[model samples]
Target: MTLGFTALVTAIVGEVAGTMSLRKATTGSKAWFVAVAGSYVFAFSMLSVSLAQGLPLGLAYGIWAAAGVALTAILSKVLFEEPLTPVMGAGIALIVGGVLLIQVGSAY
Candidate 1:
């Protein structure tokens, strides 16, 4: 279970990194294109490993996607000076709450 959780976390990180790289690549950075591709590969690999280690698909994917969105939004605000409005903040909170609910529901 610990290993599975760790893999899930890695998957989330990879996804966030991939998205960030995508932004940079879109701005004409060739190196970021490579990073975007590699990060996605790493993300999916970790996600698959986590599933194989016994994490439920619904639970794992929900957490992975939500964390990715939230982290990406926050990091983009920090790194790229992207605007994070109050509504967006509220949406992120809701996403986090939804993931928690899914996790608790899964335990049963």
Candidate 2:
């Protein structure tokens, strides 16, 4: 895989982790706040690295945001016992489809 793609994946992972940590922080675990801050910083840093490696901003950001949202939703369902309704699943699918369009369009 390309360096930019690798960095984008790392960014997505960091963003999802940071969001999960935010959920924990909201539940009164103050220690998770530190993780939230650190994860977000790392996520943005990796996003910048992806851009520096010649990844277009629109494509990179679209994929990163879409993947982060979808993964976070699924992980939250599994880890926190949160609801994952059909409507939410459809929304995630739409987001993924939109990101795919952006990726394909960028190829031309």
Candidate 3:
């Protein structure tokens, strides 16, 4: 993959990690608090780098937000045994489709 794409992926992963840590941090864990803060800082830094590398901000942010939401939901189900009802599944599908649309629209 291209460097910019790799950076965007890194940013998304960091965002997901930060969001996941938010749950544990809220329970008063100092270590988790550090993780949460660090993850977010890393994520934003990478996002900025991706933008600097010529990834369009609108497309990058749309993909980042959608992928983060979808992946976080799936990870929550796997890691925390959270529910993955049909409705939620449909919503995730919609998010993925929307991201795809954004990418396609940007290409033209």
Among all candidates shown, the one with the greatest TM-score: 2
Query: Count of backbone clashes for each model?
Result: 0, 0, 0
* Reference-based TM-score, model 1: 0.94
Q: Write the per-residue lDDT of candidate 3 for residues 19-58, one digit (tens) a residue.
A: 9999778766768989999999999999998999999998
Q: Which sequence of candidate numbers ranks them by TM-score, best first?
A: 2, 1, 3
Error of 3 at 73 (Å): 0.4
lDDT per model vs. reference: 0.94, 0.95, 0.92
lDDT for predicted candidate 1 compared with the true structure: 0.94
> Positional deviation of 80 in candidate 3, in angstroms?
1.5
Q: Is candidate 1 or candidate 3 better by TM-score?
A: 1
Tens digits of lDDT, candidate 1, 8-46: 999999999999999999987688999999999999999
Worst 10 residues of 1 by lDDT: 25-34
In model 2, the worst 10-residue window by lDDT is 99-108
Question: lDDT score, residue 89, model 2?
Answer: 99
TM-scores of all predicted structures: 0.94, 0.96, 0.93
For model 1, name the residue pairs that clash. Answer: none
Judged by lDDT, which candidate is best? 2
Clashing pairs in 3: none
> How many Å off is the CA of 98 in candidate 1?
0.8
Please state the error at residue 101 of candidate 1 in Å.
Answer: 1.3
